[model samples]
Target: MLVTIVSLWAQKLFRLDEPQPFGGAELQLTLLAKALVKRFGVEVQFITRGQGPFEIFEVDGIRVYKLAYRDFPPARTILGSWDLLRLLLSLKTDIYVQRGGGIETGIVGMASRMKNKPFLFMTSHSWDVDGTHEKNRGWIYGTLYMTGLRRAAGIVTQIQNQHDLLWHNYGRESLVLPSAHEIPAPIPIKKEGVMWVSRCETWKCPHVFLRLAEALPDLRFTMVCPQANSRELFLEISQKAAALNNVTFLPGIPFEETEPLFATHRLFINTSEKEGYPNTFVQAFKWGTPVVSLHVDPDAILSTRELGVCANGDETALRNAVKQMYCDEGWWKKYSENARSYANATHNVQVIVEKFYSLLQSLKK
Candidate 1:
């Protein structure tokens, strides 16, 4: 008698809240889901919270399990941790990946250990690791956040600096894995002016973009301020943009719908205080649009690689960069090509996804 051996494919589950409106974390999750399904034929599941009834839905070829809740508290809180613990216990997943750092991640880490499963942590922002954010400033919160990070089987950081910080502060090993970018097919259209897209958060500093618009009176500036957790900030930015003739403010649209805006934009502006490899940067690069950033430069690639302009948090430098890009067409084209080339070579979804797959496979051993 002849016997045949059977092989099994791995099932990966991601935990986050509301996969819609695609913020950085959500975009990563969505891109990972697509890559895993298309490339590796892995069974991917996303667990999220929603206002609707508890249901499983398919969005863009991924299984999304939305837990019905009136309002989901931050996972670091007592109630939030308890809810996360209960939910995590109910599911049997081969590997659990969490994108944000908080009490919820700690609770999930604990649950993974108890269930004999591997938990992979992805640092979403600088505040997630540096302990500078308000949530991680206090000793109690810092301890709690670190507890989960420490429990993770492996940690993924977006930049080398973050990896070094993790090792120095938490004594944990991490892999520097930048977020993946899906290069959109080029559209044959005339792209013009400058575009800035972000949530209306104080830390994101939309006021800086508005000031840039003020400085460049002749250039058209389009601002997309998505309403997230801060309604007041959204209104403030909206009212301010209304006063400027060169500035136009748009309410948030679905993340899938923003490709055209990026494709047609001459440049992308980022005014965030800090980031863990911003999705916007990659998005801009994929569309052959250069980026003019205030502070974020993952690996100093902006300045060193000439992907775009990095102001190093200098207002004057940032203003000059924008003006230079606007006025000099040939210079702008060079940087734009550089942006696309760098993104295609380094942050392509296929390349990053393979890295992620290898990392997850290593955890199984």
Candidate 2:
């Protein structure tokens, strides 16, 4: 029997095709979908949010269905939910997969049960599995998400931290998987400048990075933050970065355009308070560039493998670590080589997709 997997997420179909708003989970999903179709011949599809009414289109090998409806206030919420349910049931795939925590989790779960299909929940952030989402996202969002999470046939976590949290908090067992990435051939490029890339959200602490840039006036800094949650906040951060001569602020760039930045940047910095194995980290590592993170370590692989430095939530320490990575060539080269080796060994898309395929096949039995 042929296995068809549907990825349910409200995002663009592909990374390079659109300069739109998307996160690490969407990027990982796109990579996994492409690899599954190319290497294993499994049929893959996507249900995303777009500008128009319900429509279907094909990009690469995946068929994408767009759901464009507002979930505003009293009555439209019900209409929106009904429309989403109709779309989910219409797909009728072998398995339905959703990443991150949202009301769609419950919606997809209901559709899967109605269709007798297995639903897979992929954890995309630490908050999704750590029992904090209930308090963070409020009770209603949590209730709907938990309903779906409990109904999931299988769960996949990007790190052991999420797996442990899932088990401890909810008594759910999950397979630990790394975020998938396409491992590009090694290209020699002159690496310079420090780069920080993420959505301009409050929790991301983009302000801290500005301070780091101010502290180290000699080294050039690049910020590729896209607007997230608030556009006014994005403009605010952009203006702040513009005030500093050493810092260059970009609203955003295409996903394909970022790899060259990663390859040529001397350091990749992450200021997020928490994450689920950031795709940017994998990108930097794959490009043989060292990372300096403010908080997240994701399985402590950064320190364990000497791939990068984790400041452990201290701003001064983060600044110092970036300075050290930039100034010390021997230290920087060592981390860069280790990062590339670890990323290629663990996150190769073909290998990761094979593991995902095996899991999906087992579910069929």
Candidate 3:
């Protein structure tokens, strides 16, 4: 049976969230796809709504069809399907695989019915993803999230924490496919000072780190953020951090450049409002970099150990956490070790991939 991954974000040029040469969803897909192809000899194809152009490429020896898509309003997230329908019919896919969570699930399921294909919808959340911010987007949008979720042939959640929510609200019937990331071998690299890595969006709370920089003048502060139109806000942050002689700014480097950065950075900070098992935190663990992040529920691995000080938007607490992390010295190492060990055991790619392989095999039977 051929596996067709239908996604809206898969693109040709590589967007900000695209798998860096190092790792991300694309890397995860690549690893599993290569293994599936080599071991099972199953055919794997990808259908994406990438806007640029339509073409094909060999990613990790797997075939990807970069189908072009035009922009649509929110309705498509739930009911609309243009190329997605076309790809499904053309390939007569046996199993449809979509990443964690997205409103596109319903439309894909609809198309699958038309083409007689069953899909595994991977729901990456406990209740709602992270902040559940989509609820505030609009009434119809919120309803679509649930509508798209409930009608899937099968559901797959990254963590067991989310199983009850899907089972109760969406009628569960999903396998628990825990999240995973490749454990990059330890890289001997040098990074100096405190570092924060993530999209430079408002949700990441870059301003909070600016406050930390102000509080700790002696320690070095570095932020690696995507270069986007948020220049005005970034400039404002840079100025605020400037007061601390140790603070510096670096452009958003590609994932390939991140190993050395993660290796060298003494500390890692996660300032996001929400996430479904962050790629950055896994990188931090692999690199032995500890993080101080705002509270996010899906990261149960970090939350259980309390290895990460989950902040609830408390600036004073943020200040104190920074002090404890840097000023105490030994505290940082302990937390870093904790984060690394947890990731090594719990979220290792091989183990997680085995879980996925089991689910696929079960679906076949």
Candidate 4:
């Protein structure tokens, strides 16, 4: 049986150009698509935003078709629906999958219904399942996203909270699928410092991390903050980090190159106001680096499983957690071992991909 999966990922995320944007949702899409191809022999394709009217290429055995979503400015309005509809119908695939909450969600959902194909919508943020994401994006975009949400044949969320909220808000049932990852072989690391990796967005609170570094001047810290929303904000945060003698700041690092940092770090810190199971958390766990987070804790696994510490929005607690984890060798090793074991048992890419394949196959029936 041959199965084809088409994804509607953003071009900036899928492309390999210089200064390419790095996003957790996009990276998961890429990893899932590649695994589907390599492991299950699934034919994968992507329809993404592009500068040209049409551009075709391939990445890791998956085919990509670019559409000029940006060229048609009116497409931002309902008037541009037919152009996107046309592009999706042209794919002729078995099913469509997309992540995140945006106007594109509605576009993909509408196209799938028109062609009588199953469309799976995956939520990437807590806001994605809750009503806030829709309300923040405004009327037209939000309306389109709701349309896609309603029309989806299936929906997947990163955590149980999202699943419960999706049902409560929209009366939609979804599977709680943990984010997937390919585990690397265990390596010995010196594990000397704390590390933070995230796009420099206001909501992520990169500035809060700088404050943490300043407060704990005795400890070494590494901040890998790439430019997300504002270039000026990135520079501002970079300068603040540079002034801290204990902090080493890098504006960006490729997604493929981040594992070494995770492997070498004793602690991984997350300062985001909220999130849908951060990929960095999983990466840190895979590399046996304990996490100490300020706000977000997915599934409450950090506390229950002893994988890491969730500060529950306390800046002081967050700092203390980091300092304690970095200094107490025996405590750190216990959490590190638990983290690695938990990651392998729950997030192994091969097992998750098999689950997706089974779900996709059932949808076909």
Candidate 5:
């Protein structure tokens, strides 16, 4: 008699879909899901809440299931959890992953535990781990959020500092999983204007980019501001950009379009006061564009790897770095090359995705 062994396959589901007014977390989710399906043959699904009719759709090879909710926030979280729990049970998801810190994460965390399935939390921003975001600081809010974080079967952090912060503040251990980037194909570098892309939030400091554009009237500066939680700030920046001749403002486009956009620009500028291993920096490197950042460097890669100039949030230093990169072509070329080389070796999607897959498999045991 011959006996054959049957292999069991698992399906992973993300608790949220690519958010509207998309940001790094949404982009990361989309990329990771695509990589999982294309490279590893893993089945992936995204659960999204909407105010319209419930529907299911597919985008870039991932399944998206939409559930309708009536109200926002407090009620949404309560109702959304119920709907999500029902879907989780019916689909029998092997593992559930929450991409960011939110009240819903706690709800899902508890549901996963009750169902005896593994749940993982991935931190996308520094504030997610450190509780520095204003919303995370409230007593009741912090307690509820931390409860879910603590119950998670595993947590993933993009950098060592974030892992350290999680352990120090919440006593939660997390695996250090760096963000991945898709390197663009060989294309002629345009070497033109300075580019900035971010939400028009006060913390992001879009005004700093405007200031730099004013200082460097001879060089062209372009900014892409996407709609985010703060519309007033977005309008404020849009009005500010209108008054400057050297500066051009473009509405945010989809993530797929960002690589070519970055490739056309000679330099990338980051004026954000806080970050958690920004996806923008990784993309800038992959596009062969060097970064000039005000603050937030992960593991000192900017200085040690010679990827770009990191001023550690100093205004004068940021201005000087921009001037130097704008004026000196030879220096900019060297930094740009270093950026691509470093990103290729470190942020390659295949390598990072493989690491993520291993972590998922390990959690199964």
Candidate 6:
């Protein structure tokens, strides 16, 4: 089987040289591509823009062809639909996959439909809470996505939460493919303290975690962010952490380096103001680390998932939850086990790939 991906924005936004460059969705893509090539021995090629033309990379015995898209300035194909269809015909791909309709998917889905190609889109972005852009750009981009989803051959997402939310709001139904990663077996278990995987931005609400650090001085805090913003915003956060000695502000790490670092922390924290769903919950759990999160959504990660506790409402409630994680070792062990089990069940690679592969088979007829 052959899969051709239509994604330009994912390549651009995620390829930044900052912390948390690729969230859970991007990581899910990399893992899926690698596995499809190596384990399943399928032909996989990705369509992208800006990184120059088509080039091939071999990693872990898997082949990846990056077809760099270059098109007109007015913009025909800037949104991705026509140009991607052109690529699909030229490549003779059996299936055309779109990773959300942000900007690129809009292009890809349109192209796929025009050509009568099997179009499958994976909705990884959390549309409800972890929404992007302001009004003007958001509407432009959102319009593109809504249109794309409506015309897609089929749709997929990591968890039922995001999928259900999409169905509730837009009435779009997509297959639930639990996002998975190739978690590395640790060389050494370094249980230092607690850590957070998020960008230091307005929506993420990193300050809430800093407040927790303030209320609990003894515990160490290791926070990572790749989407760095302006100097003013950086300084404001720095000022908040100036007096605190236990907080370690680490820059974003690449996708290749995330797992080992995740293994070292005893617990992972999510203080996001909103989230579509998160990759950190899976990564932290893959390494047997428990998670503690502010009430974002019950779908992403939760107490029942065995990942950790979820607190809703105010900042004080979040703080109290963190203190309990440290004090209750027995409870922590139970949660740690739950995290691993949940991660394994939801994110099993073979299971979801078969789900995707089957959809393509059905679409062909």
Model 5 misses residue 232 by how many Å?
A: 2.0
Go through the candidates in order and give the clash count of each: 2, 0, 2, 0, 1, 6
Q: Tell me the tens digit of each residue's lDDT in model 1 across 1-365.
A: 00000000011123334322346876687678778888887777666655446676675566666655545444325654565577677776778888866555667678878888888888878777776643546665666667778788888998898898878877888998988978766643578989999888888899999999999898999998877676787788899999999988887766665778888889899999988788888888888889999998877889898888889899999999999897798998898889888888888888999999888888853
Identify the candidate with maximal TM-score. Answer: 2
Model 3 TM-score, all chains together:
0.82
* Candidate 6 global lDDT: 0.66
**How far out, in Å, is residue 146 in model 6?**
2.1
Error of 6 at 9 (Å): 5.2
Error of 2 at 278 (Å): 0.7
Question: What is residue 280's positional error in candidate 4, in angstroms?
Answer: 0.7
Q: What would you estimate as the lDDT of candidate 1?
A: 0.76
What is the per-residue lDDT of model 3 for residues 1-365, given as tens digits with 9 covering 90 to 100? 67887655545223444421222444455556666776667788866555456777766556778666554554444234555666667775677777654455655666666766667777543435432525564655456455556556677766665666556654565676655667776645444588887656676678777777777888888887654447777677666666667777765566667667878887777777766666677777777777777655454555577566766667787667767876665777677778778778877877877777767766652
Overall local distance difference test of candidate 4: 0.83
**Residue 230 Cα positional deviation in candidate 5, in Å, after optimal superposition:** 2.6
Q: In candidate 2, which residue ranges exceed 4 Å CA deviation?
A: 1-10, 13-20, 69-78
Choose 1 or 6, whichever is better by lDDT.
1
For candidate 5, the 10 contiguous residues with the lowest summed lDDT are 1-10
Clashing pairs in 1: 75-104, 76-103
Against the unseen true structure, what C-alpha lDDT does each candidate score?
0.76, 0.83, 0.65, 0.83, 0.76, 0.66
lDDT of 6 by residue, 138-242 (tens): 666766666666677777866777777668766777777777665444424447677887766777877887888877889998777655555566667766766
Better of 1 and 2 by lDDT: 2
